[model samples]
Target: MTKIFMAMIALLYAIPAYAMDGTAFLKQVDRNLNPESYESYRKLINVEPDGRKKEYTLFTVKKGVDKVASIFLAPASEKGRSTLRLGDNMWFYIPNVGKPIRITSLQSVVGGVFNNADILQLDYAAEYTVEKVEQNGNEYLLYLKAKTKTVAYDRLKLYADGKRKLPAKIECLTEASMLIKTIYFKEVKDFGGGVVRPAVIETDSPLYKGYKSVMIFAKVKARDFRDEAFTLTFMPNLESLR
Candidate 1:
């Protein structure tokens, strides 16, 4: 009888230790990945099924959860091109055209598996509400649903490191739970000034078959920027921020 009573007490105490608030836990994982506002340099590589590869470098900045801007830094053909995203609205600007144009979230800026939404991703906490959380061995699997219809992906399955609380993999999905793409976070590095997270994000999509895309991150440090810096008018002047 005493052993039964002790076992019941132990079970009662164990529940709260792993009994996590899904929403709060997801927010922690998001912050562990990146600051709310910051700047980063990324090299995007797109590999064709035939083994040919094309790469583009970009300098990117984000303010809050909704505002992000990026400018191509290499490949003369893609250089000077910029993209500005504010909430659900996104625009692409070409230097020769000298104007900003609307773009859909699923459209790729550099023509790869990654789309504009993937490139200019907002905080997972801001866009998704945790629908379920499960412990899968050493990782925590978080099932998320978009907070609004305008969110880029209707559903997301995120697998995060249980100890680090950083994402290990994320699966973007449609409303019907159809898989679109899988993003793998790898090569954790300390980027100085308290930023420590994945240095590489590789993605593959069923739609693209054997093609894959990778984004290598560097110099991801925290910084403050003006709201005007994320506007269409600021697209031409993005280089000035660097």
Candidate 2:
């Protein structure tokens, strides 16, 4: 009779630990998404079908808790080209144009493929709230809701690797529950220092067929960028980036 009572006490104590599963999982995923510690990486991007490849040395720096700035230097083809993001705004520098073009945060990032928000290094926590944990085989899925009017998609469903807890796939849904984009993460690797980074990301839009963008991170290394590198006034310095 005493053993049975002890076993009942143990089971009652385990309830609190089991209840922490959702919050614990959310915090773990958030830690991986925080870009503050993952300052930079050497990137290689390959656009599909065309078999085109480009290389860039990249840098990421956090301005505050909800703000991050990333810089790209593609010396091979896009030499002297610079892209900057401050909060929700993005700007580009073209050597031929001799000026920086201000790209609004909502301009739908036009380039190889994918929407502007997908490329913009914005604060994910501000825009989305995650919940409704579901497990299917080896994957865990969560429903993310846009918290503000400024967001592009109304909802996003994310599928994460069950064992690794890294993002595996993301599905975007419109305000009316229409599907818009589906992004898949492949070849994810740890970028050292406990950052689980996605090496290859392939984004596909439902509006376009036979069109997709595959970003491959060939090398990832920690880096430091001066404050001047992330400023709008310093956008035209191609020679200084090298």
Candidate 3:
């Protein structure tokens, strides 16, 4: 009995206490990806099974935890179109529409596997609560649950690199545990000014077989913005900030 008790205690001590705090580690991963407030330029590419592709370039600005806005920069048809997210509310502005329309996180503005939620993504820690964490070889797998029903995905399985503390891959699932999509992060790069993270993020969904979407980060740097920059009226002039 004494030996069995000692063995159990040894096993418990084998895992570090800090590693057990999944929430703290999740926040670390979020900060490692980007600062709390920053601006970035990205190119989103959607490829069809027939070897055809469509691309859109965007300039995205985010402030704090609840405000994020993005404006399309390329493709004449999509130019001047903007999207804003203020907490749970989201709006889409089109040049010809003349007014912003309410949109949902599940809708895709660019028409691909990547949805609005992915394009104007907030900090992961903002929407998810870490349910548990496990160490697998040199990687850490984090299980996350959505904080509200409005979130795009109800659950997520995130695998992060142990050394770099960056997400390697993520599995987005429904509340019923149905697999929706898998996202892979690759091509780590240094964007200067203490910003270093994956330059490429690729995602594919079982619901849309043979279709893949890739987002490539061209530039990401820390920059502050005014509260007005994330409002509906200011969305039309988002290009001015660039």
State which candidate has the highest TM-score: 3
Error of 2 at 75 (Å): 6.6
State, as a TM-score between 0 and 1, how close model 2 is to the true structure: 0.72
**All candidates: TM-score:** 0.91, 0.72, 0.92
What overall lDDT goes with each candidate model?
Answer: 0.91, 0.62, 0.92
User: How do the residues 1-242 of candidate 1 rate in per-residue lDDT, one tens digit apiece?
Assistant: 99999999777544432477889989898788889899999999999999999999999999998899999999999999999999999999999999999999988999999899989888999899998887755678888999999888999999899899999999999999899999999999999998889999999999999999999999999999999999988899999999
Q: List model 3 lDDT by residue over 116-136, tens digit each.
A: 999989889999999888775
What's the residue-level lDDT of 145 in candidate 3?
100
Top-down TM-score ranking: 3, 1, 2
Pairs that clash in candidate 3: none
How many pairs of residues in model 3 come into backbone collision? Answer: 0
**Candidate 2: residue 231 Cα off by (Å):** 3.0
Per-residue lDDT of model 2, residues 45-145, tens digit only: 43555666544554445443344444566555665656667655677777777777887654543355555566654555556776566665556777778
Query: Residue 145 of candidate 1: its Cα lDDT?
Result: 97
> Can you rank all candidates by lDDT, best first?
3, 1, 2
Relative to the unseen true structure, what is the C-alpha lDDT of residue 80 in candidate 3, on a scale of 0 to 100? Answer: 94
